[model samples]
Target: MELLIKWLSIALSSSVKFFAGPLLGKVYNLPWWQTAICSFLGMMVAVILFSTVARAFFHKYMKGLFNRNERRITPNKRRMVRIWNKFGISGIAFLTPILLTPIGGSIVAISFGTHPMKIIGYMAVSAAFWAIVASIGIYFIPFNFH
Candidate 1:
C-alpha cells in the first residue's frame, strides 16, 4: 500500500511538470527506464486532460466570444504569431516540454488553434524524449542530492 502510494505521488507530481516524475523516481532510487516510462505517462495524462478540456471550452464558448467581440490583437499575440510563422507547430511541440509545463504547453497549443489530438501527440513524443533525457541525466550527478 505504501509503495503504491509513493508511486502515485510521483506520477501525480510529474503530471504537473515535465521533469518532476523523473526527479521523484531518482530520489526514490527507481530504475532509470521505469522512471522514464512513469514520467512519460504522467506528462501524457496532463497533456490529454488539459488539451481536451481547454479545446472543448475554446470551441464551445471562447471562439464565439472572440468572434463577437472583434478584439484587437495584443502585442503578445503578435509575438506568438511571429514565432508561429518562424517555428510552426513542430517547433512548438518540440520546445513545450523543455520550456513549459505540460498544462501550460497544452493550453498554449489550444490557444493557437491546434487540434487537440495533435497537441497530445506532440506531448507524447516530447514527454518521452524529456523523460529519458532527464532520468539519465539525473544518474550522472556526481554529488549526492539526498
Candidate 2:
C-alpha cells in the first residue's frame, strides 16, 4: 500500500507537471526505472486525455467561452506560430516535457489541427525520452535535499 501510494504520487505529479516527477523520485529515493516508467505513463495519460476527450468536450460545451471573434494577435501567439512553422510537431514534442505541460502541449497540437494519433505518437516518444533523462539525472546526481 505504501509503495502504491508512492507510485501514484509520482504519476500524479508528472501528470500535472513533468519536472515534479523526477524531483519527487529523487526525494523519495525511488529507483530510476520506476521514476521513468511512472512519469512517462503519467504524461502520456494527460496527452491522451487532453488530445481526445477533453478537446471534444471543450469544443462542444465550452465554445461560447472562447469567443473566436475576440481573438487578437499577441506576441506569444506569434512566437508560437513561428515555432510551429519552423519546428512543426517534432519541435513541439521536444519542448513538451521541457517547456510545456503534457496537457498544454496537446492543446497546442490540437489547435493546430494535427491528427490525434500523431499528437499521441510524438508525445509518447517525448515523454519516454524526457522521463528517462530526468530520472537518470536526478537519481545519479548527488543533491543536498536538505
By lDDT, who's the top model here? 2
Error of 1 at 4 (Å): 2.6
Candidate 2: regions farther than 4 A off: 61-71
Clashing pairs in model 2?
none
Worst ten in a row by lDDT for model 2: 58-67
Please, what are the lDDT tens digits per residue for candidate 2 over residues 1-146?
98888888999899899989988988888899998999998998899999898778767886676566887889867877888999998888889888789988888887777888999999898999999999999888888897
Cα error of candidate 1 at position 69, Å: 6.7
Clashes by residue pair, model 1: none
Model 1 regions lying over 4 Å from their true place: 63-79
What's the residue-level lDDT of 56 in candidate 1?
A: 88
| Candidate 1: 10-residue stretch with minimal lDDT | 137-146
- Residue 129 lDDT (model 2): 96
How high is each candidate's TM-score? 0.83, 0.91
